[model samples]
Target: MYKILIVEDQEKIRNELGELLRRYGYEVVIIEEFENVLEDIKKAEAHLILLDINLPVYDGYYICKEIRQTLDTPIIIVTSRDSDMDELMSMNLGADDFVTKPYNTQILLARISVLLKRAYAGYQEVVQFNNFKINFSKGILINDGQEVELTKNEMKILACLTKDKGCIVSREDLVSYLWDSEWFVDDNTLTVNINRLRKKFESIGVENVIQTKRGQGYFIE
Candidate 1:
């Protein structure tokens, strides 16, 4: 099931939407802590987000901007502000769709279903490996039927290796993929992350999937 994150402060509306989406077989998570909306979103690994414009600590626009920095997940602004400018601004800020308050639940459901279908309907059509599933849309890794939470660097490294499975990726290429043009990263930091990732793979019985090529670099078979 796809995961949806609801970032509305009103308990009634949030619960209502959550129940509506859950009925359609989507796993919905309503944000309870408004102070750390971005952190909650990252942890939830939501495929889409239902965001409200008017929030307590910070508005939805700020949250949307922050989310777009690292995540390309679809976002729909579900708010009371129903103006052309609001809709345009939301779209400009990376929101895929906008729905006003007191919306027809059926219409909302239809739009959500269409978006989900368009985005992820054919995602799981093929299984890659015995213990790994790739979410091409969200760039997430699933191991042994559970999502493997990876750090930013870990994901980048894994992505690079997965792209060239069985082919060796040099250390220099891995550093370039992770660091900026000017920034420098310590070699020890990369080793530590690789060790942690190996442990994560071991937990799912994919031990030594990432084989070190010693003098060359690393490869996944």
Candidate 2:
């Protein structure tokens, strides 16, 4: 199911929207924290966002800018501010769609479905974890808004782990997978690759990616 993050401050409206989306078979996440809306967005790891412009401290425009800097997660502005200027500003801030309040719930859901289809086409290629988006195709790791360059081997290792998330991946299995790619690398070199990957993740504010199991191989925790 697609995950939808609602950033509206109105309690009644937030719950209403959340329940409505839930009825449509979508996973809904509501942001209770207004101070660090950006942090909330990252943690949600949502496929799309429903934002209200009239927020407490920072408006939705600023929050939209923060999200645009790193993620391409589709955003739809949900506000009572209905004007060309408001819509234009939202577009400039990288909002994908804008819907005013008092709008039809069915219409809102339709718009969300359109944006999700355009952005994720059923599901996204990247895997989300701890605010990190790992794009196996590009061999890149995007954490928060920071981009971390990943080597081919590093991508392979991560791809393996993400494939079997929360499970142990034996070193011997990793070596076998690498060998199939005709990239012959010994255990020491594998360790070097893992360390390099960990450092890159740390550079992007992720201190740990892979964890050791002593006699066992490794697991991403």
Top candidate on lDDT is: 2
Query: Given candidate 1, what's the lDDT at residue 171?
Result: 83
Off-target runs (Cα >4 Å) in candidate 1 are: 126-164, 167-219
Task: List the candidate 2 regions with Cα displacement exceeding 4 Å.
Answer: 122-221
Q: What lDDT is obtained when candidate 1 is compared to the true structure?
A: 0.77
Q: 178 in model 1: Cα distance from truth in Å?
A: 15
Candidate 1 residues 18-66, lDDT tens each? 9988888888888988877788887776777899999989899988888
lDDT scores of the candidates, listed in order = 0.77, 0.79
How many residue pairs clash (N, CA or C atoms closer than 3 angstroms) in each of the candidate models, in the order given? 0, 0
| lDDT (10s digit) by residue, model 2, range 28-122 | 99997798888878766677889999999899999998876545578899999999999999999889999998999999999998986665332
lDDT, candidate 2, at 120: 38
- With candidate 2 superimposed using the best TM-score fit, by how many Å does residue 4's alpha carbon deviate from the native? 0.4
Name the lDDT value of residue 26 in candidate 2. 92
